[model samples]
Target chain A: MSKVTTAANQFAARRGFNQIANRLFTGIVWLIGICTIVFICGLLFLILKKGLPELDWSFLYGLPSEMEEGGGIGPLIFNSFYVLVISLVISIPLGMAAGIYLAEFAPATKFIAFIRICVEGLASVPSIIFGLFGIALFVEALDIGLTIIGGAVSLAFLNLPVLTRVTEESIKAVPKELKHASFALGSTHLQTIRRVLIPVALNGIITGICLTAGRAFGESAVIILTAGVSSSGEMWDFSLYSPGATLAVHLWYVQSEAIVPDAQLIAEKSAAVLVFVVLLINIVFRVPLWLNERKTR
Target chain B: MQSVASQTLIDIHKLNLYYGQFHALKDVTMDIPEKAITAFIGPSGCGKSTLLRTLNRMNDMIPGTRIEGKVAIGGADIYSKEVDVETLRKKVGMVFQQPNPFPKSIYDNIAYGPRLHGIRGKQKLDEIVETSLRSAALWDEVKDYLKRSALSFSGGQQQRLCIARAIAVNPDILLMDEATSALDPISTLKIEELAQELKDKYTIVMVTHNMHQAARVSNQTVFFLNGEVVEFAETEKLFSNPRDQRTEDYISGRFG
Candidate 1:
């Protein structure tokens, strides 16, 4: 009787230890989760606290002044959107096609594997290098000094590898059975890609496009080297030859140069706008994914 | 082993199939008759499913698969240079073991094959969709929800939807690669009955793991072991009095 009681006590003691350990582990995970939420909330609060008061119409739509106090970011905003749209137009279709070719048509030879490695390597190359290449090609060789076309083209080059990798991975993620089903139903290679592969992979591809677009919009280093730090001072300048200074570049200049008394305000509001626009891009792209999910569910 | 050559819809002569260096199917020969249900039964890795895929050239999708000898269906060698793979696939529709319905609506899944053949009229497509689903015995269950996503259906219903999609193209041969292996027994019975009914029109060739399934539904049965044919005979005779000892042992649960 004493032996059995001792054994029971030992088992109960071990169970007690396990319960305490489990509680500790759960507490640590909850702590991490709370920290992440607090950090994001604090960052958004800081930006919007100083910025939201200055987001009036004149500050947003008025012209930038070199020496004056109340300059608007109208032209810079236009240039930012123009550059993003142009780069996306150049990159998306080409990158998606290259991805499809790699995933479906390319044979699984050593050479193809080598090509895939190179693509991954290219995706990781620093964005500054592309900016330098743009300067060399457009500004130096072509003698077109720091223009919108150079900046947009360089941004497109930076977007290409990332887009290609995303598209290829998403296409490959589709179940092989789906492709087989399509083929068994008499679809040719091209037909299967158009009807089945693209539709199924659409969500991932859209997410990729949004990420790249948001990154391209907030990019300053490439624009600094290729498109200069000043806009053409026209709110509606459509000419590719004109200098294209995006809102991000303008924010950088105002923060560092501090030429006007309102520079601090401009920088603060610009940061808010940048973060807000990026969030908008993600949400907008996600709408379609939500619709797709509902259908499948 | 052979069925009557004159009535054969699928004629195989000394067939061999290799995956890279691995010989998946050896020099096997058989003839499957038209408008009859034929079953290929064997253990896993016995090349039975591979043989079914060969009918529609689905094996061509694999990277390094190789085939030799003859697989002539309807008097045409499918491996001939002039044969269009897409056309061959159209004439020989396949249903896989796991139901694979596209993420589209039920109507769209059934309409996909017909749409590929340029049937653009709304009325004609609707007609095809209804009849195909009806023939597959899924119309009564899904008729009200044609716009619902195919993924929303139960597994058995989705398998039926796949069958409906396959027949929408109006093929002469229906290849079922273990079509009911992934289903519950009730769903399996439904598909078995459908197969029997379909044999009056389409030449049905199936690969199955269940020996009783072979005996119950098939007109003829082919037993394979290690990529070679062990026996081929009428289903009833094969079950009751298998000619080869290997076939007898397999059916009587002596060894696989």
Candidate 2:
């Protein structure tokens, strides 16, 4: 009878220990989640509180002044968009084609494996290193100086690896059965990729583009090195060879070395706009994926 | 069914296939009659599907795959250097075990093949889509929802739609690789009936694991074992009184 009582006590102790462990794990997980939420919320609140008061129509549409207290970011915004367009136009076709060749056409050889490893290494390299490379290649060697084309070309180099990797993964995710069906229906290799493969992988490709666009939008190091830290002449001057300062670079300049008294205010508003645009891009890309899931269900 | 009067549509002569060093098909030889359903039956890994894929050179897509000897369809050698694989495949369409409809509108899925073949006019595409769907007996079910995504259909309907898509190209032969195995019994029966009707117009070659399915639908049945043809005879004779001892054992459920 004594032995039986001892066994029962041990069993009860083990069950109690298990319950405590489960509760501890649950609490730790919840704490991590809550901490992340709190951190993001706090950051957003601080930025909005400091920036929203200065965000007026004139701040958006007005010209920047060298000596005055009130200055606008109109030319900076235009230059940012113009550089983005040039980069995308250069990178999208080349990246997607390279991705297709790697994913579908290239045989598994030692050389191919080496190429893959190089691409992965390039993807992990710092953006600052790309800035240095851009200065060496475009600004100095090519005699382009600090121009919009130089900056856009540098940004294209930065975007290529990301777009290539995304395209490769998306193309690889397409079902093998679909390819077989296309071939059995008498489609040539190129025809099958054009008609079936691209359409299916389009969603993932768009997501990749949005990701690259967001990264390029907030990029300052490469733009500063290649496009310079200042713009001259009229607000709408769109020459490819002219030096341009993008919004992110302008924010950095305003905070550190602007002669204007309201530099801090301009920096805060620019930060807000940058963050908001990135969030909007993410939402725009994700909505299609969500709608596709809903429709299939 | 083997009365020696029907013209041979596909003639395989001493066919041997290999994937790298592994021999997959061993000296396969068979004569498929025109306008008839020929069913291939065996246990798993028996190379029945491999042989079906070889008919249209689908095995060419695999790396390090090699084929020796001859495969002729309608007295023309398909493996010759002069023969274009794409044109060969156009004459021999295939359906897979799983129903694989493109993630597009029903009308677009049906029109995909014709469009690839350069059928661009809207009215011509509309006529072909309707005719193909009608031939596969899926017209009335999906006539109202031509614009709806093909993924929205039931499994059976999707399979039939795939059949319609295959037929839209108007191929002379159809190869089905265990096409009904993934469907329900009712869907399987419908497909079996559809195959029977299709044989009147197109030469049908099907690979199936189901012995009953082979007995029920095919005019000629070929049994495979270990990458070789064990027996090839009329369906009734092969089931009722298989000449080979191994065929008898397999049909009697003694072994795989």
Candidate 3:
């Protein structure tokens, strides 16, 4: 009877072990799912709590008065848009071409492999280093001074490595059969890329661009060094010689060092507005992909 | 059928292809009659697909591939020194086994071939898109939403769209490499029917593992084994009474 009881207990132990393992598996899945939802909610709640109350058209468009008077971030906003656009114009084509070479045309060789390693290294280097390089090359050597061109050029370098990697990955994600189909239809290599490959990968590439743009827009350390702190409240400027202070730099300057009576309010308002604008830009950029996903479904 | 009988579409002579040191195709020779179906049936790696790809110079795009042969469409040697591969391909279109429609709208996928050859006007493009879709037997199901993404279609419809894309350029010959292999039986039947309808206007050469498919669609059948032609005869004759025992073994499913 004792031996029979031992066998029965062992069977029960085995069943208990399976039950515990199964419960653990399901618990982990639920934990991940719940954590993701909670994190997203936390982000949205914090941004809204700090940002929504301060936003107004007057605050966005009004010119800055003296240090004591409450002023707007109009000049900083204009400068941010200008620098972001110019930087994109410079970096996008070059990075995309490099990606195409690496993905489509590059032979499997040690030299090509070395170049890929270098690009990966470039992506990991800190933004401060890029800022220093820009100051040395564009600001001092090129005699560009502290201006928008120097800052835009710096941002372009910062964006290139990331954009190139993204472009290559997106292009690679396109099925091989699509290229073969295009070729069999008598389209040349260039034609196939333009008509088939690019269109298919457009969503992924655009997402990469949006992320890069966000980085450039919010960067403080890089822009403060390359572009001067001085900003004029003009919305339109074609010349690249003007001094510009983007919104991020403005928030940093006001909060840390400005001795004005309204500096505290300005910091709070600027932080709020800045967060809102960034969120707005990200949502606007992602709208196309969201609609596309729905249509495909 | 009336206009097709007068034109000699494709003439291949003494063809050989190699991948590095491995010989893929061995001295293949054949004449593809105009606007008729010629099917290549063989075991796997018998070089049927390789020979089919050579007709449109699709092999040129592959790396480390070499060919020693003559493939001419409309009496122009496609592999000659002065010949342009792009133009040659334009005249000899191809459809693949997997349904490979462009990641674009149904209309844009069909219109891509004609657009590249400088068919710019929207009205002319619309006409070509419609006619091509109709020829491929996909127009009625897809006519309402030409702007919809091509990937939204079923597997069979997507294969038909590929055929429409190929034919929209008005090529002299169409090459299909197991074009219906990835599709279901009903889809395969529709595509085969489309192939029959297309032969009245375009010459077609197909490579298929399915002997029944080749028998049902092709007027002529070329049997190959171990990179050599075992027998070449009318489709009925080749299936009913194969001269080569190797061909008999392959058709009987002894071994691939």
Candidate 4:
């Protein structure tokens, strides 16, 4: 009876060890997942706490004035939209075409592999370096003054590598069967891409575009060096040659001790607008994904 | 006794297909008759699907693959430099083993091929979609929800939609590669019936592993083994009185 009891105790101890180990493994994974969610929500809460109260028609629509306490981000907002649209116009087609080449058209070879590595490396390069490049080429060499076009072109170069990678990934995510099915029906490769591949990957592409737009909208270093400090007179001017200040640059400029008397107010208001615009763009981007989910189900 | 040009719609003469260095198809030679369901039955990896794809020059899509023999459709060598691959494909359509309907509205799925082939205007496309769906035996089930996405359909309906899409272009030949092998018995029978009806207007070259399905739907059957055609004859004769012992063994369920 004593021998039997000793064996049972040993078995129980072993089982207990395994149970603890299994629980610990599961607990660690769960902790990681919860922490990620908590971190994201915490960051958003912090930004909103500091930024949301500054949202008002006066702060949003009123023109900037030296005497005014909370003038407006109207010019900055307009400039941001302008720069974003232009940059996307330059980047989307070129990046998407390059992405298509990499994902679908590039023949497997050493040169193609080298080009792919370069693209990945370019994506990791600093944004400030892009600003420097822009100042050197567009501002100095090209003699394009500190204008919206110059800023937009700079941002396009910065965003192209990321945009192309995302587009390629999304395009590649579409099942090969879909392309094969289209080809079997006699569609040319170009036709298949135009009709089936693009439409199917539209959500992913739009998501990438929104992310790029958000990055462009919040960009400070590139806009500061390339586009300059302020718009030329009119807030609603549609001219690309005019100097522009995007939301992020406006925040940075206002937060600085120089020039702005109401630095805190200006920073808070600009930050609020920036948060709102980013969220809005993201929501708009997700609409296609929602529709796709509904359609597939 | 008849010349291949007169009776056959798709003529394959010494058709050799090589995938890189490995010979995938070895001197495959056969003729597919016009307006008939011709089934290619063989063990897996016997180049049955390869032969079906060759009729429409679909093997051109694969890289590093080359063909050493000629495949002619309607007396024109499809491999010729003068051949317009797009036009040839429009004339000869295909349906795959898995049901692959475009992730679009049921109407759009049917009208896509026709629209690409230059049929414009909503009314014409609507008519074509409706008629093609009807021909594929899917009209009654899908008439009310033409605007709904095709993914909502059952597997069988999706396959039928694919068939409708293939036929919408008004192709002279329809190539089906084990199209209904994924469907249930009831769905398989329905597709077989649709195949029978389609043969009146189009030539069908189907590949199937099911001996019963081959016997039931096809008029002519070609038996393939080890990348070569073992026996070719009328479907009934091939099943009941196969000249090749390999064909007999396969048909009798001895082994593939």
Candidate 5:
């Protein structure tokens, strides 16, 4: 009877220990989740608190005045959008074609493997290196002399590897049975890709485009080297050969070397706008995916 | 029980297939008749599905796959230099074991093949979608929800939708590669019933693991073993009195 009582006591103790351990794990998981939420919230709060007061309409639309106290980011904003459009126009078709070739047509030869490795390596290379290369090739060799086209081309190079990888992965993820069904229905390879593959992988392709757009919007190094630190005098000057400064590059210039007295305020407001636009781009892309999920349900 | 009125549509003359070093199909020669259901039965890795894929050259997509001898459809050599593979495939449509509808609206899913073949008018697409869905017996279920995604349908409905997608192209042949294996019993029965009706308009070939399914739905059954055709006979005769000892043993549940 004494031995039975001892055994029962041990079992109860083990059960209590398991309960404590489970509770500890649960607490740790919750703590990690809460920490991430708090960190993001804190960063957003800091940016808004410092930037909201200075973000007036004039500061957004009026031209930047070097000698004046209050200067606007109109040219910077226009140039940012200009450079983004140019880069996306150059990258999307070329990247998607390369991606399709890699995913569908490229054989399993050693040469193909080598190309894949090179693509991955290029993806990991720093943006700064691409910026330097852009200066050498577009600004110096091509004699473009800090033109918007030069900057845009450099940004396209930076976005290409990422877009290609995303496209290949998304295309590869499409079910092989779908391809088989298309081929069985007397569709050629090109027709099948155009009708079935592209539509199915459209979500991933959009995500890739959004990601590259966001990166190009916030990039400073490539723009500074290839597009220069000043825009044309006109607010909406869209000449490809004109010097341009994107928003991120303008922010850096305002913080480091602006002649205006309210440079710090301008920088803070620019940072806030940058963060907000990126967030908006993410939400815009996610809407379609969310609707797709809801409709299937 | 062999039907005398059926005419030969596909003739295989000493066909051999290889996947790199592996001899997947050997000396496979048979005459598949038109406007009838011909079922291929075998154990796993028995080359039944491979032969079905060969009917439409679907195996051409796989790397390192090689074929020898000849396959003729309606007295035309399919592998000849003059024959375009795309046109040949248009003559032969296929359904997979898993229902693989494009992730699109129900109407778009059926209209994909028609559109690829360059049918563009709104009125024409609408008519084709309606008729094809009706042919697959899924019109009433999905008629109101034509704008909804095809994936929203139940598994059985999706399989039928896939059939509708295939039939929209008006192919002369339909190949089903174990098309009902992933479905429930009710869905399987529904597909089997649909196959029976489809054979009146198109030549039907199916690969099935279930012996009873072969016996129940197929008019002619081909039994395959070790990448070779072991027996080819009428479904009734093959099941009741299999000529080969291997066919008899396999049908009697002796061995695969």
Candidate 6:
């Protein structure tokens, strides 16, 4: 009432209001974060609780039963890993080469921009579309039928654009100062790329590789269309001509169409395995990089 | 003002550079003395660094950049068709404002340039690394930790390591673009002293924002403004007695 003009008193009401609002906002954010973590944990728990008891070595490596109570996914598991390795072998080098060319060697032209757009568009395309393309190329064109090679080539196609984008971004993220330094030392552009840029961008590239690897490992639709719904029924078939149904495909098959009485149990266990391995892939790839960073720093 | 006559190592003739539609440097011509330090002083965006880059053809990396000039180093026209850019760069080394030591061991950092030129022997690489580090006044401090990562060093030490790396290739000319602008005062003084010693063997051309650094380290000084050379003279005479109003005004801090 007396119109006190002290600095602290002048803004006291606003300051107090701000403090309350700040705390309220912080509380809401924390609650949201905790809820998200709880949801994820609940999902993981639901799968593991129903599946972990049934999971065992023989169940993982035994042959399937058409009308019996018990069946395993040994050949399916083998196909999953085999297809993954082959696809990576096909995609990694090609993708990284394309990425390097785009980032370092491509001239600043409209044609180059168009190519970049094409790569980005392909990276976002649906995996099912790639499966269809695989069918066109392998099943229709080459007459190979549903086979491991077809599945792997289609998976490679899916992986290529993602890998290229990730690699280009990673290389582009390397500091300009590093490139300048290398060139100043009279190193050729090719030499600088190999000796400096690749090494520096390797961490981000590896992370991209892990992410794509996880996606490809658990991929279902592509394998279903291109590799078929059945494995060769052998534990270790290395031939590319074999039917390459993977664990993810088998999980879907058991739940939807398989005649086995314990199909639900098998699906649950395989889903758990899929999630667990995806999580494991990221950790395994990143730990060595983290350790090396610590050792240097 | 006295002009000390010396053998010319680098001769620029009517150099004009354009970044697409924009003219970055115009009609720049100067003769750099052999085995002496020449400093280029100008404000930011004054084309000082651009001219320095032209010496080694580093500007070739920039897209939409065009040049019409003859930059002859040691009597060879570097811009001519027969001149291989890689070989020219090998003869003319560069250091940048920020200390950019590779993410490698200190020994490997110094050895990288030599290795690129095909010095594969362990003993030879060891010797080059030692001599280069000693030349940069960094050998004693880093000798015990030669295996340590270059990125692990302090700012000043890392800059010295970069200098050592540049020298390991044994270039005839060294171009430093604000090499000490990012360093502290003590480190700056250390580098200035190092530059003074380096001038005895290599022709050094440096572009610096610091007027004091130019006065302290350079034998010849060139003042540039708006892509034009305002004055070029011996450093001592130019500092004490100016011949051009723009150069004097810039030197006196009237306008940068």
Global local distance difference test of model 4:
0.87
Model 3: per-residue Cα lDDT over B81-159, one tens digit each:
9988878888888999999887678998989999988899999999999999999998999999899989889999999
lDDT score for residue B31 of model 2: 99
Candidate 5 lDDT score relative to the true structure: 0.91
Residues B110-229, candidate 5, lDDT per residue (tens digit)? 998888888999999999999999999999999999999988889999999999999999999999999999999999999999999999999999999999999999999999999999
Model 6: per-residue Cα lDDT over B1-256, one tens digit each: 2265789999998999999998999899999999899999988888999999999999998988999978888889998989888778888999899999988889888999998888999999999999999999999999999988988888989998988999999999999999998999999888889998998889999999999989988999999998888889899988889899988999999988
Q: Predicted chain A of model 6: TM-score relative to the true chain A?
A: 0.93
Best model number under TM-score = 1
What tens-digit string does per-residue lDDT give for candidate 4 at B148-235?
Answer: 9998888899999999999998899999999999999889999999999998899999999888899999888998887899999988
Judge the docking of candidate 1 as incorrect, acceptable, medium or high: medium
lDDT of 2 by residue, A191-215 (tens): 9999888878878888898999899
Q: Give the Å shift of residue B78 in candidate 1.
A: 0.8
lDDT for A128 (candidate 1)? 90
Once fitted onto the true fold, the runs of candidate 1 whose alpha carbons sit more than 4 angstroms away are A1-21, B1-6
Give the distance in Å from residue A141's predicted Cα in candidate 4 to where it truly belongs: 0.7
Chain B TM (all candidates): 0.97, 0.98, 0.96, 0.96, 0.98, 0.98
Candidate 2 chain B: worst-modelled 10 consecutive residues by lDDT: B1-10
The global C-alpha lDDT for each of the candidates, from Candidate 1 onward, is 0.91, 0.90, 0.86, 0.87, 0.91, 0.91
lDDT of 5 by residue, A197-227 (tens): 8877878988898888898889999999999
Which segments of candidate 3 are over 4 A away from where they belong? A1-19, A36-40, A55-58, A62-66, A232-239, A290-297, B1-8
Can you list the residue pairs that collide in candidate 4?
A: none
TM-score (C-alpha) between model 3 and the true structure: 0.90
How badly does each model clash, as a count of residue pairs?
0, 0, 0, 0, 0, 0
How do the residues B123-240 of candidate 1 rate in per-residue lDDT, one tens digit apiece? 9999999999998999999999999999988999999999999999999999999999999999999999999899888999999999999988998999999999999988988999
Number of the top-ranking candidate, with DockQ as the measure: 1
How closely does chain A match the true chain A in each prediction, as TM-score? 0.92, 0.89, 0.87, 0.89, 0.90, 0.93
